[model samples]
Every structure is written in structure tokens, then in C-alpha cells.
Target chain A: MVGFEVDAVLGDPAIRIVVCCGSGGVGKTTTAAALALRAAEQHGRRTVVLTIDPARRLAQSLGLTELDNTPRQVKDAPLYAMQLDMKRTFDEVVLTHTAPERAKEIFANPFYQAMSSTFAGTQEYMAMEKLGQLRAADEWDLIVVDTPPSRSALDFLDAPARLGRFLDGKMLRLLSGTARAGGRSMFNLVTASFGAFSKAVQKILGAQLLTDLSGFVSALDSMFGGFRERAEHTYRVLQDPQTAFVLVAAPEPDAVREAAYFASRLEEGRMPLAGLVLNRVHTSAVPELDAESSAAAAARLGEEGDTARVLRVHELLMRQVVRETEVAAHFTDRFPLVPVARVPAQPTDVHDIAGLRAIGDAF
Target chain B: MSWPARLHVVTGKGGVGKTTVAAALALALAAGGNRVLLVEVEGRQGLAQLFDLEPLPYAERRLGDIDDDLRLLAVDPEEALLEYLDLFYKMGRAGRVLRKLGAIDFATTIAPGLRDILLTGKVKEATTRTDEAGRRLYHAVVLDAPPTGRIGRFLNVTAEAARLAKLGPIKSQSEGVAALLRSPMTSVHLVTLLEEMPVQETTDALAELTALHIPVGKIIVNAARPPLLSSRVTQAELKRGLAEAGLPTDRRTVTGLQSEAHAHLARQELEQQLRAELAHLKRPTVELPLLSDGVDLPGLQHLAALLRPR
Candidate 1:
């Protein structure tokens, strides 16, 4: 297997952004953090890692508790880490894009409050929004992004467009138009389907909810174009040669399948997929001792002896190694050209700088 | 043996085999002539893949060969919303018009918590659905719910929808769903691996679910691997054992095998520590062994047998 040159990506002066995306529980957050740390410590680059919903200990390790939405330097290193606060980022975008009164109105709207905080796609969209903001600031030599733990790996890529399309869709336009016209002009619209649409929406969501949503939409109407443009710009940044998308996955069926799906999706989108980081890969110390031979040796010795127990352990490890290899091979076989960096499974969870440094070393 | 709850909402961190666990649990529940419905809400069509069937539609279909009483449903928020409207307002043509105009998408996707409300609303319907004789149609309902990170908010439909709909059928429906979720008839079982991140998320989710007053059931430890060797075994013994067993006694091979054993023991210790921590949570814990060959129907049946109440 060809090794993914982690240092090449880290040391490359042209690559300004590295996006680590994968299925959840595959150590995407740790990968992003380690990459950022490596870029800072090894490559001597100013780097900031943006993590979305890191584990509590991982957050504490990165000093993310003290820095909520803004990047703060972790210890003395040039590495900086910040957990994404989606609502705050959304509010910041609104405040920066609109006037104070309009921002306040938008913030005060119930629907806006709900959408900003708990909307299904809000985190993904806001993560991208924050990424765009970070890149546009031009303060860091490299930026590493940890995509959100969405139900599907593709959600992080599809969310911004989905939200943008929803906001710019005709339904919202009609609703905002109705709100702007005080509900009278909807009847005067060109088509009866429009009336039926409004009635149906109103019937499902109720009259007050529609009013609140329209109020929120009208407040956000001026910024919808900006939202779409920013998403597209960030997307282009992702597609640029300067940015690299590293798909991370464990040597498991589900995670590898997700990585395959994401790799294809990135290819379809013309996004620069640098390589795949196969995390938590298991390997046997003795490649010569196959599982079958080890199991046979164990059976010959019986289970009570130390030699038998060692052989049993060797058998188990060999089986796991084979399983992991086969699972990882699924991805490598599908995408033969994609370089893979396998990070051996660590005995303990990574929650400190030394742990992250070890992971970077593994890469 | 009766289950603890009629509705079992299985949630875990992403990639933790919650869908597999839920399917197996449903199969277990459907044993002995009991009817069970396994629900998937994430639109992932995971149930279909698990059962080796085609992508399931909104309607229920029997999971053949596994258990005749076991059924599967992939709930779409759009379909759920339309059904809700038809049930409440009878807006048949208006629903079609809304679909044509993308209002359905707008309502389900754009409206905060509306999608979750609709999804759980469907689950609640299945849970409480009764027959002509006023008997429960399904003996058990297993929901392959959202991940633990959002399970609390996902199940808390009333509070989530309160911001969107202050006073309407949506509000009332969410209220009803919330009531059912908070009732003793429902249990939100958390699935986790014996790893740091999943266990941490499970702990956090347990705290959150407890605070939200949702009934939590067992803590399912999925993909648990047993300790292969005793901790007292020494590296010296392993080298001697390797030579005695006619394996290569070379430095590299011995060292490699020793290191692999070291990692394996270390991982077993870590798993033991995590298991102890989970035990401190005071919930009944069920540990499912790792399926080395990966999950298929027979594997799923094996898991179901393990999940079956003794």
C-alpha cells in the first residue's frame, strides 16, 4: 500500500486549508487537531484547527473551553483550536452582514432563534460559514477543519447548499412576500397553486408559525444572497488546489463505506481529496504466525498454560489484523489511486498534546 | 418474559451499530409469536440493508425469514407531514399542491424541529397504534433513533416544536408525542462501544436524557471483545512459549508478537476500565460480542438470540 505523505500535505506551502471529514466516531476531530499541531510544530506554520463538537476531554486538551467560537492559541505552540459554536457563528454572520436593528430583529424572531440554534443543517452551514470567515481573515498559514458528526458523511457537504436552496426557494419567497404584503397580496398572485401552497403550509405549520417563519425569512431576506455566495466561495476554496480534503475512517465496514461514499462525492464535486487516513488500524507483531497456526498451537498446548494463553492472544490479534486489513482493503480496492495513511490503534484515548503528537507521528 | 418497555428507542454515537442492535432487539422482541416493528428515521435505509431487502418505503413491510412478526419502516419527514395533515385537516389536494411547490420540503426541512417532530410523531403513532379489539398492534417498537449527541433534543419534541408552533395541531401533536416519550412505556436505550469517545458521549447522553425526564433503559455495550489472555502473562513467557510452540523465535517476530500482546492487554484493560465506569451508571448493561465476520442475517439472528430476554 502506498503511504499518504502527511508531511508533504503539512509542509506544502501552497495548501492553505486541510478539511478532515469522515463518519462519526472515526477520530475525525483528533485527526484535524493532530494535523494542525503537526503543521504548527513540524512544518513551522501558523495553524488553527476548527473542531465541531469535540469530546469533552478532547476539548479540554485543546483549551477549547476557554475559547468558545474564536481561535485561541493552545499552549505555546502556533497551533490554535476552537470548537464551533454554530448559533454564535450564525449570529455573528447576521450582525456583520446586516444593520444592528435588523440583526436584532432577526435575532429576536422565534423562528430565527430556533433555526440558528437547532436547525438540522445549521451546524454544517455555520461550520462552512466559519471556515469562510477564517479563510477570508487570512491570519493563519494553514487551517484544519473537523466536519460535523452528521448522520451521513455527505451531510457536511450537502447542508450548505440544502439550506441555501431552502432559503432561496420560491416557498420562502412567497411566504416573505406574503409577510411583506400583510397577507393580502398572496391572493393576487398569478397562480392558484400559490394560494393552495400557502394554505397547505399554513394548515400544516399553523398560521402563527408561518407568520413567525415569514418574519424570520423577511429579516434574513437581504442576507440570503450573501449566504449562498459565501457558501459557494467556501466551496470553491475547498475545490481549490490550496485546500485538501483528507477522508478519515476506521478499518470498519461502515466507516470505510462512508469514506468511499465521501471520496466519490468529493470527486464528483471536483474537490481535492488528498488521501484517506485509516485510523485505528490493527496489526500483528508477528506476520509469520498466522491465526490458523497460532490457534492450532494454542489448541495443542491447551488453554491453562502461559504458552497456550499467549498463542490464543496471538490468534486473536492475528484475526483482528486480518479483519482490519480486509475491511481497509475494501476502500483501497475501490479507490486504488488514493494514498492511505494507517494510524495504528492506540491503547488509550488521546486527550493530551503528547497523545496527539504520537498520532501525528503515526501519520 | 416481558420487556421493560413497549417502545425501545436505541441511540448511540454514529458508527456504533445502533441500527444493527435495534434490528436484533426487534427480532428478539418478535420471538415467541410477538409482533415487533423496527423503525429507522435517518433516511439511511439501513434497516433494508440489514434485512437484505430493498429500500423500505414509508409503509410497514414484514421482515421475511427473520421473523414473520418483525416489520420495518423508514419514516420520511415529508410523508409523515402529509399524513399528519391528511389526518388532521384532510388537505388531500392541497398536500399535492404543496408537494409540487416545495412547501413540503420547506416545512419539513426549514422549520426547526418540525422534521424531528414528524419523525417521532410517526414512531409515537406506531407505538400507540392499537387494533379493533383495542389491543396493541405491535408487541414492541424499536426505534433506530438519532445519535446520542442529539437524542435528547430529538426525543424532546414538545420543547423543540414549541418555538416553531405556539398553538396548533403541530404543537398538540408534539405534546402528545412528548407525553408518550416521557411515559413509562418508552425506554431510550443507549448503545456504545468500549472506547473513550463513544462511552463519553453515552455518559453525556445519559445525563441529558435523565435531565429531560425521558425513561432510559439498558446501556448496550456493542462490539465488545473479550480479553484473550490473562494479565499476569509476561513477555518472557511469551517468547519461550513461541519457541516451544514451533513458531519463529527471532528477535523481530518475538518482539512483534510481544508488542501485539502488550497492545491487546492494554486495550483489554482499557475496556475493563470503561466497563467499570459504565457499571457505575447503575443501568443494566448488555454486552454484544464483536462479529468478526461482520453482520449478516444469521449474525443478526445470533445477536437477536443474545438480546432475547432469558
Candidate 2:
């Protein structure tokens, strides 16, 4: 039931972290960018925005030709931006936790490469890892993060535990343990050693590939616990009062439903939710008139004239306005205390700093 | 020639109405009197909620009046794997043992490709299933697949399953699923909105599908609004129209009309620009109206009728 006071959150010295989360195509990234820009330009806080979107629209709008893992300061604003390179972040985590030789061996593993880049939930996990790193650096007064665009991103709360379980799974330990024992006794050791499960795995994966996989798993097993520990620390940080979660949604049924779904999730997780921001709301010019009256008036005005056409256009607008009101009311009724800030749909997509500035003004 | 494929994988950026579009397509295809099974793999229960029906179980259930031929199934990876094991290996009790031993979790997580294989294998099985007369059980199977972000890997089952399990029924099953997916009998439709981010993601999905060698189907644009006024509305014309309407001379009413006219003009421009950009993708396209009553059964039927042409 928190009132989403964007400027108030930005102005508070104690509130250092802002997380913008929503389903994809709901302008979550744009909201994060605008939040960062507003915090930096108006509130005079040094800010950085991290986004997981592969699209370089954020980079292009920030006037940068390209964005890599490293944060770069924007041209005129007091803001910095960076795109999370999942594979690079995963590699860095591995390299930091493992020996140089072992890390190199792990890096060359095909399975490792694939998991680091394209695994279902890896981007969200890496994004959380990056958030922890940025917070630890203590450079920016305000940090805004745009969560990855996936329903799975909501399961980020379980990432650390899941990764931990996968890393500590018996198969890895058994494979690595046997790989170090010796290749000659590998089959005998696997069969006499673990159980039918390991035997099935070995027979299925083939001897040569099993050897390569075991070598890879064995080399990287030491740092297994660190990944989970860091993720857990960040998960705790997300629950801190200093962190504000802003749920953004467009004025559509699906998007609104998703926003509510995410809000409830944040509540369950005990994350500090600032409030909901309803983006691209349609506010009609003729607010007092009902849709029925407007339609009737347009019909009575006749259909063949320019005036009639204009009235017909007005009727359409009125209907949209009425529809938007009903949609808005549903959210308000469901989440009574969740204060909403409505931003009108822009005539065009926000491309440059001016567009961001205009949005800042609108809100 | 109606829809062109027995299997249609409906995918797009998140929040772009993939569920609605897929449901509409399923209804449309079934309206042709073909038996259709619409399967969802993400475990979203999106179909149930979209239709306001009971939450679908992993097992296929017949949705009520849509058609006897049109059925919906929510496929969970875990259930799909167990079914796959039981079906392929006839390992009913052994499948329970694999679950207890965490073999299922290992395959699903450590070897993520198997998850996709399980999902696609179910779809392939449905499409390839035949009755005594050799007529396919489901003439059409519409898959509400994963989003564009993961679809490339999701459909590249052959390569991924090969990377992990080199031999056994798993490898052979994955190859079979891959063959169906890569064949002319499969088509993937990408749903998107006429906005910059969605259009960008649509293009990215198209490029990835091209690289994956999957044929692109129609581009379905959801929640599209009709243009009220052309972008070229002149200020003088607007003023004259307001005067000719003869409804109001009050300052407030006049101002309201003017603002409404301006907003409509702006929207028309934005719509044109975004749609023009999306058209650059060069795929056959379908546009569905943004319903005023919001998402409902009647609205879904409206969308279904709209998708009938495609």
C-alpha cells in the first residue's frame, strides 16, 4: 500500500537501490533509465542504471554506440549505464573463485559456455550478481536495475539455492571424484562405486565425453559454494528497507494482471515495494461524458459530414477513456493502498535524452 | 493452405499476448473442423486464465464449447519427461525411481536441452499420432511455446540433446522431434505489438529463427487500435469541424474537443510509424483490434475471427 513517490524515493539519501520489474514490452527498461536520469539530473545523486535487455536501444538513447559489461558515464548527465554480459559475469565469478589453471579448463568446457550464456534463468542470476557488485563498489549514490524480461526472472529468489544444488549434486562429485581416481578403473569404480544411476549416466554420455565432462566438472567444483553465497547476500539486500521495488505496467489487462502478480510476489519475498507505476495510461479529454452519451451524440450528428466524422473520432476516444477508467479502477480496487502515478502514452517512442526528460516532467 | 502446418509454435516478446494469439489461432484452426490440440509448455496456465476455464492439468483436457476437436493441454517439463520415459522406455516404475534418484532434475537442469526435447517431443507425438484409419488424431497442434528469447534453443533440440546424451532413446527421441520441427509441417508465428521494443524483439526473433532454419509464419500484432484521424489533420480543419458540430461554445467543452482531436492525431502518427517499421520484417501479417471491454471470451472470439484470414 505504499504510495509510489518516485522523487521522494530518489531524494531520500537512505534509499540507494531501485529495481524496475515487469513483464516484457511494458517499458520497464525505459522506466529504469528515466528514473536514473531523473535521480542524477534533478536530485543531484550520482546514479547508474543496469539493464539486462540485449536490445541496444538503451545504449543508443544514452548516446553510446555500444555497451559492454563495464559501466560508462553518460555524456552530459551524472548517470552511468551498462548491459549485463551474462557469460562474462559468469566467467568472472568462476575465475575469482577458482585457480587460474582450473578456471581456464572450466572456461573451455562447452557445457560451461552454453550454461553461462543461454541457460533459462542465468541472466537474472547474473543480473543479481552484478547488483551485488555495484552495491559493494559504493561509487553510485543511486542504483537502478531493470530486471531481465522473463517470467522466470521472478524465480531469481531461488537462483542461489538452485545453483548451489546443481553444483553440489552427487553426479558432479562422483564424476569429478572418479575422473581424478584414474581412467582405467573409471568404469569399475563407477559401477562398484555409486549406483545404477551413475552407471546409466556413464553409458548414456559415452566414455570419451564422460571423461571430458568429468574433467570439466572436477576442475570447477571448488568455487561451487561462492555463487550461492553471493546470490543469497544480494537476495537479503533486496529485502533491505533501502531498496525500493517499482512495478511498472501498461494500461492493458494482461500487463496489469502481470503487474499485480509481480507485486504479490515482491510482498511474499518481503521486498520493499515503493508502489506501482501505471505507464502509458490513456486519459481522455472529455472526462465527464459517458461512452453511451458520446456515441449517441455522434450518431445523431449524422455520418456523411466532416463534423460527423470528427464526432465519430471523439466517440472512439471517449470509449478508450472509459475503458481505461474501468481498467484503472480494477487495479485501484484490488490494491487499495498502492498509490499509482499515471504517465500518458507518448506520441512516439522515447529515443533520446529529451524524451526521457519529457517523461520526467510528465510524471 | 489454410494455416500451412500441422504444428504452429506461437512465440513473441513477453506481455505481447502470445497466449491470446495462440488461443485465437487454435480456435480459428478448429473452426475449419480440424481436430486441434493447443499445448502450452511454459507452465504459465495462460490458456486456462485466458479462457476463464479451470486451470489445466498437465494432462490434455477438452475445453468446453470451442469445439469437440479443439483441446488444450498444459505441459509441465517434469510430467512430460515422466511420460516420455514411460512411453519410450516403458519404464513406469523405473521412471518413479529416476524421479526419486533426482535423475529427472539432473536431466532438466544440468542438461537443459532435454527439457526442450521433452516439450517438443510431446508436441511431435501429438501431431504424429494416428487412429486405426491412419488419420492424425489431432489434425493441427498449436504450441504456445517459450518466448522469443529462448525459442532458438527450445527448437534446436537435435543439437542440444546431442551435446549431452550421445546415445540411447533420449538421443533418438530428440532427433525425431528435431525432424518434425525442421520439416515443412512446422511453422512458428511471432506475436508482437507495433512499438519499438516489440518490433525490435520481433526482428531479433526472425533473425534467430532464420539462423535456426525454422520457417517463419505470420506476424500477429495484438491489441492494435484503429486510427481515428489521419496524421494530416489541419488545425484550421479541426477548428472548422468543431464550429460546424454546433454542440458547445463553452470554453471548457471547446478545449476538451481540441485536446481530444490533438491526441487522436498524435496516436495516428505513432501507429503509422511503428507499423511501418514492423512491416519491414517482410512477413505476412495479421492485426487484431484492442478490445475496449478488455480480455474476455467474446473478445477472444473477435480475435479468432480476425485470425481466420491467416
Candidate 3:
């Protein structure tokens, strides 16, 4: 298999944005940070990494004890790192697009508070929103985005549309009393089912939640149009020719399966997929010594000696290498054309600039 | 003897095999001819994948031909919400109408914690359910919950909802779920690998669960690798042993093998360090070995046997 040209993607001036996406705990954040650091340090490009990892692993890797919503420079390098503050980003969007008083009212609404902080898709949406903000700023020559650790890697792609549908959903408008004033036929349908519908909703969510939701919807009604439009605009930016998508995964069954799914989803969405970063892949030092032969040799000699133990260790390594290869082949065989850059499993966790640089060197 | 708890909530960092652990635990509980329910709430269809079945519906289905005692349920929040309405308010027709109008999506998705509330609500229902003969419907229920990063918030969402609802069935239901989650009958087990990041996340999750007053179960260490070589094996000894084994004694092969052995030793040392860290938490810990062949039905059974109560 041809190796993925990591440096080529990072150095390509035409590709302004690179999005690293995969399932949770697949080293997506590490890949993004490493790519950004390499672009800034090796390729001599100004780079910024926007990470949505709630654990803040990127901050520790960048040697910053803390990362705020805004980008901070890492050491003397041209690279900048920031963790997405989903709630604050949502609030900023509201505050920027709405009047101060209305923004305050929306913030005060319990539904708005919940939606801003704990909503299912809010992190993905805010990550996109922050990406749009960073790209519009145009301070960095390159932007590397680490998507949210969603259950499905495709959630980042689906979030904008989901949020748009929810904000423009007829049920929300009806609950907020906007549909009653918009169309006569719609108003008739609303009136016909409004009593029963609201009764069910109220009964399930209770009257307080319904009231708060209605208040939240009405307060943010004016900004809804902007929200959807911006979401659409950022989504378009993602689809632009200048953007590149890198699918990161470990040499595990689930992660590789997700990467395959995400690659196909990107193809369906007309997004440019650069390649796959197969992280934490196990490799055998002596590939010539097969697991079967090693195990047989170990058994021929008794298990008591150091030579037998060494043979056993070699056997274990060979087996792990075979399993990882088979697991990775599951993806590569399906998408044979997808370039792969396999990073050998590290002996310890990456927690500093040197460790990230080593990863970059591997890439 | 019975298991330690009737409801086992298995959570871990993503890719740490929580779903697999939960399934194994369910199978272990069912080994004694006890009826067990394994539930998945992430909508990831992980149980379906683990069991090699089609995507599971909101209904409970038998796992396989091995036994009739074990069943699986992939709880969908939307379905749970509609079911809740039908059960509590008898709003069957209204629920369908709401579904068409997108109110169901709004109620389940837009509300911050309502989706989680609905999910845990259903789990609580299964935990406390009784049959016509006044016998427990399930002897045990194992929940494959969200990862540790969100486990605290996911389990405690009912408290937040209770504060928000303030009235009606939602409020009472939230309070009921909260009580069930905090009760002694429930135990939240955290699964982790012997790696820095996962162990760190496990420790943090333990603190959060403790602070939330949720019952903490055993710390389950998954994918633990056994030490293959003695730590005292020296580089010179390894080289001599390779020559004695009739393997290549060339410098290149010797260098490669030595480097590999060094990495293996370093990883083993790190694992030992993490084991100590987890031991300091003072929770009963269980270790599951790494399955080199990847997880399958037989492998799951192997794991289940290890999980069986002694």
C-alpha cells in the first residue's frame, strides 16, 4: 500500500483546512495536533488546532496547563491550540447575532441553558461554528480541526442539518405561536391538533419545560435565520476544495469500521478525503519469525529457560502483529485506494511536545 | 450465590470494550439459570454487532441459541418517550400525532437531559418490573451505558430534569429514576485498559460518580496483557538465548529483537504502574485478558466465564 503523504497534505497551500475525524478514543485529537504542529514547525505555515476533546488531552500535549476558548500559542512555535467551549460558543453565537437584551433573555431561559450546554448535538455544531469563526479570522495559513468525540463519526457532518431542522421545525414554531400567525392552512392544522398535541407534550415534559422551550424559541426567533444560514455556510466551507478530510483510526475492529463508514460518508457528501491515519498499530521486530514457528520452537525447548520465554514473547508480538494487520486490512481491502499512514504503537502515552514531534516524524 | 447487585451499569472510555464487558456480565449472570436483560442505550447497535444480529429494535429479543435466559434490548430514547407517554398518560394516538409533527424529536433531542432521562427511566422500569405472578421480570439487568466522559451527566440527568420540570409526571419520573440510580441495588462498573489516558479517565469518572452519590461498583480492567518475559532478562542474555535457540545471531536481527524486547518491557512496566494507581482507589478490581483473535461469540463466552461469581 502506498503511504499517506502527510507532509504533502500539510504543505499544500491550496488545502487551507484539514479536518481529522473518527470514532471516540482513536487518537483523532493527537493526529490533529501533530499535523498542525508539523505544518507550523516543519512546513513553515501558521497553523491553529481547534479541538473538541472534553478531556483536554490536546492541552497537555501542547504543554499548556489549560486551554481556553481562544487560541493560544504553543511555546515559540507558530502553532496555536484551543479547546472548544461548547456552551460559550453557543452563547457567543447568540450574543453576536441578537440584541443584547434578547440574548440575555435567551440565556436566562432554562431551555436555552440546557441546549447551549447539554444538548446532544451542540458540541458538534459549536465546533463547526468555531471553525467558521477561525477560518473567517484568516490569521493562520492552515487550520486543523479535531471533531467532537461523537458516538458516530458522521455526527459532525449531520449536526448542522439536524440543528437547522430543529430550529425551523414546525412543532417548535407551533409551540412558540409563530405557525399560528404564518399560514391559514397550517394554522387550521395546528388548531385541530394543537390541544391534543400540546397536551401530550405538556404531559410528558411538564408545563414548566414547555413554557421554557416556548420562551426560548420566541426569544431567539429573530436569530434563527442567521443560525441556519451560518451553519449552512460553514458546512459549505467544509465541502470546499480547499478543505481536506483525514480519517484517523486505531488498528482495532471498531475504529477501523468507523473509519470505513466515515470515508464512504465523506464520499457521499462530496468531501475530499485525503487518507487514513492508522494509529497504534503493532509491528513485529522480526517479521521473518512467524508466530507458529516461534511458538513451536518455544515448546520444543522447555518453558523454563530464558530462551523459551524470549520465544514466547516473540510469539505474542507476532500474533498481535497478525491480528492488527488483519484488522487494518478490513478497511484497506474495502477501500484499497485510500492511502494509509500507520503509526507504530508507542511505549507510553504522548503528553508533551517531544512526544507529539515523534508522532509527527512518524507521519 | 447471587451477584452483588441486580442492576449493573457498565461504562468506560470509548474503545475500551464496555459493550463487550456488559454482554459478558449479562451472560455470566444468566449462567445460573437466572433471567438477565442486557440493555444498550447509545443507539450504537453495539449489542447487535456483538451478538451478530440485525440492528435491534426497542423491544427485547433473545440473544442466541445458547440459552433462553439472556435477552438484549437497544433502548431508543424516542421510542422510550412515546412509551412513557402511552404508559403514564394513555396518549397513544396523541403520541403518533406528535411523532408526525416532529414534536417527538423536539422533546427527545432538544431538551438537554430529557433523552437521557427517558433512557434511564426505561432501564429503571425494567429493573423494578414484575410479572402477573408478582415475580421479578428479570433477575438481573446489565446496562451498556455511555462512556465515562459523559457517564456522570448521563446518570444524573434525572436530577437536572427534576429541577427543570418542577411538576407533573416528568418531575415525579425524574425523581424516581434518580432514586433508583443512587440506590444500593444499582452498581456502576467502570471498564478501563492499562493505559495512561484510560486509567486517568477512569479515576476521574470514579470521583464524579462518587460525588454524584451514585453507587460505585468494581473497577474492571479490560484488555490486560500478561507479562511474557521475566523483567530480569538482560540484553546479553537475550542475545545468547537467541543463538542457543538456533535463530539468526546477526547484529541486525539481534538489534531488532532487543529493541522489541525493550518496548515490551517498557509497556509491562507502565502497566504495573497503572495497576498500582488503580489499586490505590481501594475498589475491588477485576482484570480481563487481551483476546488476540478479536472478540467473537466464543471469545465473549470466555470473558463471561471469567466474570462468573466465584
Best by DockQ: 1
List model 1 lDDT by residue over B202-227, tens digit each. Answer: 89999999999999999999999878
User: Please, what are the lDDT tens digits per residue for candidate 1 over residues A66-113?
Assistant: 546878989756688888999889999998889999999999998888
Clashes of each: 1, 0, 0
Clashing pairs in 1: A285-B256
lDDT of 1 at A60: 85
By TM-score, the candidates rank as 3, 1, 2
Among the candidates, what TM-score does chain A have in each?
Answer: 0.95, 0.89, 0.97
Minimum summed lDDT over a 10-residue window in model 2 chain A is located at A185-194
Q: After the best TM-score superposition of candidate 2, give how far the Cα of residue B261 lies from its true spot, in angstroms.
A: 2.1
**Could you give the CAPRI-style class of model 3?**
medium
DockQ-superior candidate, 1 or 3: 1
Model 2 / residue B179 / CA error / Å:
2.2
TM-score for each model: 0.96, 0.92, 0.98
* Model 3 DockQ, alpha carbons vs. true complex: 0.69
Q: By summed lDDT, which 10 consecutive residues of candidate 3 chain A come out lowest?
A: A54-63
